[model samples]
Target: MAAKEKLSGNIIQRSAIFLENIGKRFAAGIEELGYVMVLFVECVYWVLTGFRRKQPVRVAAVFKEVREIGVNALLIVSVLCLAVGVMLSIQGIATLKQFGQELWVVDLVAQSVTREFAPLIVGILVAGRSGSAITARIGTMNESQELDALRVIGINPVRHLAAPVLVGMMISVPLLTIVGDFMGIMGSALFTGTEIDMPLDVYIQRTFEALKPDDIHQGLIKASVFAIIIALVGVSNGFQVGSGAEGVGRSTTRSVVLSISCIVVADMIFTYFLNIGTLT
Candidate 1:
């Protein structure tokens, strides 16, 4: 009976050790991911320096990715924005109507959508849609020896692949954010007139009056940062992929997760900094 008890204790100790090791492994993986992101950003910075010379930027490729990612994503953005806007209007009207201030619905809807929901939701959607696609495309190319072929031909993979994607995302995301804000407002207006007693003109006037240029600019800025995060994370995951189908799948998953995490963190940081900047 003593031996059995001792054996059980040892088993528990071993299991604890195994779990600790697993935790360490996860921490290491996360640290490696952070390092990879830093390196990728550094590389992009240097590539942009070369683009300043007016030769390294691939206009055609950047345009192509922009159209594919931004244009293709419009339907989803519009639908989601409209749905959220309608929901926001319903909730805001319900709460504010009690105060006899249903007019405030416009301000609430506009500010919330432009300053918060539009950028964050669009960022998440872009990360999920375009980010995974970027990872898979680059990973498949790497696995197919295409990247190596580019290298052999004396072309820089970072410039050819990463640059265009990063540039495209940077351009596309801000535009999408603006579109989302508009769609959200439209939806909110629809809800206001149909469901609530608020006049459309009053809602529009309130929205325009409540929204400052800084609000719109801040939203675009957040979207831009999120765009960079998504592109960088996606490309880094692609570059890190090993040689197999499983590797592509893993990279795709990592890209989406990392991009979304970065977007959230960056958005928080941007908001804090913007407030600080305004205060000062």
Candidate 2:
């Protein structure tokens, strides 16, 4: 009887520990979310009040962020989207040829690139690249006590650090998405002309016919939201970093993972609403 009782007690103890850990994790996540929201509010407040003498934005920092997050990322975005275009065209051509509807490959590539692939691919790449960089940079500063120094000098760290990144991301990501869209279309056109016996002018005309203004708008909107998510999550993780190089590395990893997860969830929500509207 004593042995059986001990075994039951052990099971209960393990269960309690598991529940406790889960609760702790849940509480931590909630707290982190609250902190991020507060930071976002603080950033918006700073931007809105920037014209007033009470809170002037650092314009130079904003410009620097724009260069870093957008200009520096252009080549990679173009290359990746170009590859996506080629692959998409190849697959689309193969599938449509079976039905003797290969001309519709233009529609497939144009609509898919503008409405879905370009924005999503750009967002994911930015999260992995720029998002991780933001986290590492901020985390390093935190570890080195530079953030504390800023606070000591009466600087609001969020305003000094995060606001520029936020503004830059909001502006740059959509621009990058536009570039990606153009490049992707160009790629498809090139492939169709070189490999599929389609003329360049004909391909271009068909592609434009297949594309709508709404498709471009939706892609830009999604890109903007994704930019916000990447910047916020990256900066938040940076501020949450512990001490040492290890902390910086861990924070960077978390930033990428969290940003991508948030982007995907937001994409799903946007897609669902858009489809619902279309159906109605």
Candidate 3:
């Protein structure tokens, strides 16, 4: 009887501890999300009033970030998008040729690239590249107490650090998506014409004809939202940085992982709503 009671008590204690840990983790996750929301709202406020407020946005900072997030990222985005385009065309042609609809590859590539792949791929790439950089940069600053110095010097860190990045990402992501869209279409056209033995002009015309403005605008909108997610998540992780070089590294990794996760989830939500009526 004593042995049985002891075993039952041990099981109960372990279960209680497990539940306690689960609750703590759940609470922590909720707190993190709430903090990100607060940061986002602060960013929006700064956007609306930073120029009129004590801290006008630094044009140099915004321009510098634009060069970093947008210009520097162009080549990799172009190359990867081009490869995706070619691969998509090959798959599209292989499937469509069965029904004597090989030319439909143009439609497939254009719509798929513009409405989905371009925005998603670029957003993810930015999340990996720019998002991680945002976290690391800010995290390093925080570790060095530079952010505190800014605060003491009468500059809002959100306006000075995070908001410029917010603006930069918003500008950069949509532009990259546009470039990705163009590159992807051109990529498909380059390979498909030779593979299908079709003229380049005809392929180009078919692509324009198949793609609607709505298809393209949907992607741009998605890119804009993805930019917001990446910037806010990165900034939040930076502000959350703990005390060491290890902390900075950990926060940077978290920023990339969380930014990518949020981007994908936002993409799904955007795709569903933007194409709800078209679902069959």
Candidate 4:
């Protein structure tokens, strides 16, 4: 029994040591991440500077990413928006009806969908779809030594790859949010029509009547911030990718996860600020 106790104690000690080592590695990694973030910011800064100088025109690349990221992301955005609209309308109607405030369903659905769900869902979809693809593409390029070749040839990788994606996302995410808001309203109208005997036109009219300027402004603002986060996180993870195929996969996954996480956190911050403003 004593020997078994000693053995267990030794195992526990080794586990604690291993955990401490992991903690140290994680702390070091976080410190390295700060440096990497600074580098990425500098890269973006220089890319913008070069654009001002016209060393390479950024228009075509921006257009390409808009087409690739925004256009390619439509189906997922549509599906998610539809689901969100349907769920919110159904739940909103059910809850409000129980309180004899069913007419507020339009207001509730429109406000929630337009002001938050639309941008949030679109951001998540874009992060998972477009952002992951961008990460994978960059990771593949890095792994294939294309980035090294660009460096040898005096081409800037950030200007060539990251900037275009960043600019594209800045354009694409807001456009996508607009599309999603429209789709969500349509979905909500359809659901309300079926569930509450309201005509689609009436539901839409009521929804629009309930929407305020802040709703639209906040949603757009969130989309813009989310776009920046998606680009930065995606490109950062991509640039950090290791040499193997698995590294590319991991980087892509991390990009999506980080982008989504950032979006959520940003959304919370926006929500707090907006709510505070509303109260005032």
* Index of the highest-lDDT prediction: 3
Clashing pairs in 1: none
Candidate 2: which stretches are off by over 4 Å? none
What lDDT does candidate 3 reach at residue 219? 95
lDDT (C-alpha, whole model) for all candidates: 0.89, 0.92, 0.93, 0.86
TM-score of each: 0.87, 0.96, 0.96, 0.89
228: Cα error in model 3, Å: 0.4
| Candidate 2 per-residue lDDT over residues 1-280, each given as its tens digit | 9999999999999999999999999999999989999989988988888668465669889989889999999999999999999999999989998999988999999989988999999999999989999999999999999999999998888889999999999988999999999999999999988878999999998888888899999999999999999999999999999888999999999999999999999999998887687877
- As a whole number from 0 to 100, the lDDT of residue 30 in candidate 1 is 86
- Candidate 2 deviation (Cα RMSD): 1.4
* TM-score for candidate 3: 0.96
Collision count of model 4: 0
Q: What lDDT score is found at residue 39 in candidate 3?
A: 85
Write the candidate numbers in order of decreasing TM-score. 3, 2, 4, 1
Query: Higher-TM-score candidate among 3 and 4?
Result: 3
Error of 3 at 185 (Å): 0.5
State the lDDT of candidate 3 residue by residue for 1-280, as single tens digits.
Answer: 9999999999999999999999999999999989988888887898788778767777799889899999999999999999999999999998998999987888899999999999999999999999999999999999999999999998889989988999999999999999999999999999997897878888888888999999999999999999999999999999989999999999999999988998899999999999998995
lDDT of 4: 0.86
RMSD of each: 2.9, 1.4, 1.4, 2.6
Span of ten consecutive residues with least summed lDDT in model 1: 46-55
